[model samples]
Target chain A: MISQNSQTILNVQNLHANTQNTEILKGINLTVKSGEIHAIMGLNGSGKSTLAKVLAGHPDYEITQGSIQFDQQDLLALDSEERAQAGVFLAFQYPIEIPGVANSQFLRLAYNTIQSKRGNDELDPLEFDDFVREKMKLLEMNPDFLDRSVNEGFSGGEKKRNEILQMALLEPKLGVLDETDSGLDIDALKIVAKGVNHLSNEHNAMILITHYQRLLDHIVPDYVHVMESGRIIKTGGKELALELEKHGYDWLHDNLQNNAGATA
Target chain B: MNALANIDYLSSLLQTLSTQNPGDFPKDLLPENNFPWLKQLRTQAIDQAGQFKWPTTRDEEWRFTDISPLSTLTFKPAQPGNSPALADVSPFFIEEANNRLVFVDGFFTPELSNVNHKNQLVVGNLAELATSHSDVIEHHLGQHFKSQKNLFSALNTAFLKDCAVIIAPQNTVITQPVHILYIATQAETTHYPRCLVVGQTNSQATVIEDYIALQKPANSSYITNSVAEFSLAANAQIRHFRIQRENSSAFHLANCAVSLDYASRYQAVSVTLGASISRYNLDIGLRAEAAECIIDGLALISSDQLADTHTCIDHLQPNCVSHQQHKCIADEGAHAVFNGKIIVRPDAQRTDSSQSSRNLLLSNQAKIDAKPQLEIFADDVKCAHGATVGQLDNEEIFYLKSRGIPELTARNLLTYAFGAEILNRISIASLKHTLEQIVLNQTQHH
Candidate 1:
């Protein structure tokens, strides 16, 4: 048995998934420990987003060959909402706009869904309101934002902040931030990073999927993984991100091509 | 054969009033035989009514709404009654400066009607105005609203003796809306109330028609066949509203036909709250460029009642637009029907039209039939139509319930949201407030 301090919270081995017969994530392996922040950086079409979506059990992606375990439980065996109740949260890159549904109301639903799955009594409106207001204050969000429609007519900054707000409310064990830094200004980036930092604890983990090293300046991940052609070609510490920024991805591409030629 | 003979006997009795010499029938009245086309049209109407069987469940349009009660009636044509004084019907309108037309048993009560400006407002019988204003009457009386295939409209044109005529001249804006109140008094009787409104170029006006049943016991069974026609010239604007609050034993068949020229606008609103069986047909024609029309309707039905609204907007010219939205809330064993068609012709390019019909069924027994159709021949136009029938949203209800609001209050709030889309379009403040109140009361108690 692995020690509690070093036990893996999530383990994905050679994950191969496809959507409509088109392979998206090919031969990927990842491991995340509790209380750690990992950043996955790749170019467009490199399947970084696809990996995040597959981890969350999105219906559009079919897992062809993969084994995912969360807390030693089978992760791929669960459905989307069930995966959600099992303490997996994905901050959507482009959050769905559900007209006529309030933001706070949606959060309460997600929170209650998790609670009920854990065999707990659902909080009534007053209790939920009190609970949500406290979390909103911690994020510096106006309490009135909870009454507005879910992501309807919300600005980019507000949408990203609301995503963090949801993460705070649900308090999931594993969170995937999918392109959360896209379309945000510098000030918004700091606020979002601060919220995310505040939510991470000894039992919870987060994976930040992005393309720019600029977002890394704020989140400051413990490790950075470089992905190319649906495979993690390199993994290093925070200084490796600075090295990639200075040398660009061309050096890594050349190294990968030489390595593949030698192996063939 | 027996029913035809009975109606024939009633027709002869009604014809006796026509024989009271042309002098007694008012000097300005149009001679019935002079309008050859109307004569032919009337005969066609009577013949068509005789050809088709009464609407039954076998017909697709009338499937959900059973007309058995209407078919079983042997309704005699209502004659002018003498018991209720004209003052009884005249009190429905304000006593301020304006015009009022009151009809009892389908006959115009001239003494009760007060026309402040005879030239601006023409408040008299249709036959009388046809003779006085022949040039205007000859060109428009039946020109816009022909019976064609509509049997009820044809029957209304055939018995067009005692209808109301209202005409506003060019650039004239009537401060007060002209009110026409029709009261049904006798049991097992039928009344056809027709009204014609013409707004010349650059004119603005409002017309309100209220149909109420006034009887002691209020259990009288009757049928009202009503038709209204409007013609708006360029830059003319008109607001027309109809409120039907008849007794539960009454059957109502109403039609509103409108025509708009270049750059003109017209709005037609119908509110159906009462009556056992009610049907409203609205047809709007935009014949020139930049013309706009809006038809907003709502129906609140309960207690085994049936309400049906059929609307059609024909875009015949380029750059013309029209919008239609209808909502129905059914409770108890009630059923509602909505059929909206928007047609864009080949020449009507750049036309923008949209239609939506939504129904909320409050009970398991309640049902709704919603059909929103678009027939577009123009390729460059933006035309879309949709229809949805469902119950209250469970998530919305749960959300509301979590806010300390009782389950019933939450239900009412969500229901109000369902009906708010159409009510918010009403431009008049007082009317909208009154409608909101009525809707709240109806939803809360139910």
Candidate 2:
């Protein structure tokens, strides 16, 4: 639960983003405070993924209107890398495969870059090897994955575990999991949720963007928000997810249409 | 008039050649000890070269590359004793080479070369070997390369004398590679460097022919015509690498011909990075059954540079295999071309051959033309060929940037990786490492 004294980590107001002159996110508003977990559940084409990408500053999306404040700073002014350095991490739904670069080298470079940006001492290859091995144990990742190309031939579960491994290494202030539960088996989903739970603390917050409430079962969310047509249509406690799972999204869709017709 | 225009450059070069005195050429540029037969061969080649016309844009082989600049300029034969300091050649030198031959302007520089494994193989200057190892040299040199119709090949043979020669005797395996560095130092000068390698029966070896030049001059215009001939006896395995990293304003034309006997294997890799205009012609002839040939190449061109590679592999006997993979990266108005052809003769049944040419264009103005051809006269053969040219995937770039890597770093990494695909074929670990570093540095600079 988010206490009254908890400070806000991410605040958005009337966020609007579009691509190719077609608006995807008409207007979105959300507030994520420290020491809390918020789950954004939506059906297909409801712009949940768009919200995740816009938060990470994807170049393809244009923010025509609205403001995003992270740690009380203008998040819209920052580039993707700058936002990453400022403590925002987005776990992609589909990770990309870089063929030639070894996973260890890429992870080390990213780790050192962020460390140096924060004015912290960086680890050399040897120290990083030991440090990363320890982090990999949390995700049950095999040691051989370090020598292979980043996500080149990894299975779906392996790719998701790698993403969580990076999040554990970066230790960002706010973590956004975009459909992290997709393509994962029940056992793999449990491991991922457990890893995320282990990383969360009082100072860092997380936003879980998912389609199914099954993921929320493993890692219970403090608040549940229903998204429809690029906007948050409903907000409730943890029980809302169970209710949505029980009744499905058809009832919500019918109820929203009837409400709009009645208002007109 | 159109035909005349097609051979205009060749005609102009002939005009310049008609006034030359072939006899007045330096002693090092002629046959060793004035061998009458060798001298006669040179005379015949030069005579034939005089009648042949230089290829022009109208010719299918030279369609994408234009040699108008070479036709307009007057080039003098490069003289000896004008070599740059050792510091200038050190960057191109590999530390792992057991035997090395350094040639400055086509003349062997003994002071800078090192030959230590005399017991395992014979490595020395070709001119001296022509006199000392006459029996071994006469049977192989100039015997395998019979057709001198190609202008550049004829030119190189006509003016070649001080070449590098490596001979691995029967059952001999040279662990370390033989490195030959050919360096050019002057503008408006032409250098013809030749290399001959004979691997006897059951012999195995690797040879690296590295072509480089001194730092860029005010007028960085020169010409290098190089030729290398290899003879692999039955059961022999030879790996050859031809690396051309010359000055940006230079023009380089080279030909590498190989003849393989039964069960012999030959892998030849050509890496072209420097020179304003560079062209490589690779020809491999599998004369006996079970012979395997692999021809791989990579060209990285930028800033108005042009690099073209033409490869031909002939399977003359049955049960032979040939594979070719050529890649090119063009950026910033550069142009790259690849033409690969594989021929399976009528008697060469059960021949397996594969050819691929992949190209990446980094800029909108960059151009790449790749043509992979396969001709199979035999009924039972497995032959496949393909060509592709495209830009980097936007999704890849965005993915990299999403990981906090800058756009420039992501591009460089991707470009370097693309070139590394071919470099990975190199078996020498240190050479691969050095080439990777060069690829990284060069790609980042662009």
Per-candidate clashes, comma-separated: 0, 0
Docking band of candidate 2: acceptable
- Chain B fold agreement for model 1, TM-score: 0.87
lDDT of each: 0.77, 0.86
lDDT string, candidate 1, B390-446, tens digits: 988765554333222345655776676566556666655666666677777777643
Scoring only the A-chain of each prediction against the true A-chain gives TM-scores of 0.94, 0.97
Evaluated with TM-score, which candidate comes out highest?
A: 2
List candidate 1 segments past 4 Å from native: A1-264, B1-53, B60-63, B82-98, B110-114, B118-124
| C-alpha TM-score for every candidate | 0.63, 0.84
lDDT tens digits by residue: candidate 1, A25-59:
89999999888888999889999989988887766
Q: Model 1 in CAPRI terms: which quality?
A: incorrect
Query: Model 2: clashing residue pairs?
Result: none
Against the true structure, candidate 1 reaches a TM-score of 0.63
DockQ of 1: 0.04
- All candidates: CA RMSD (Å): 8.7, 4.4
Candidate 2's displacement at residue A150, Å, is 3.7
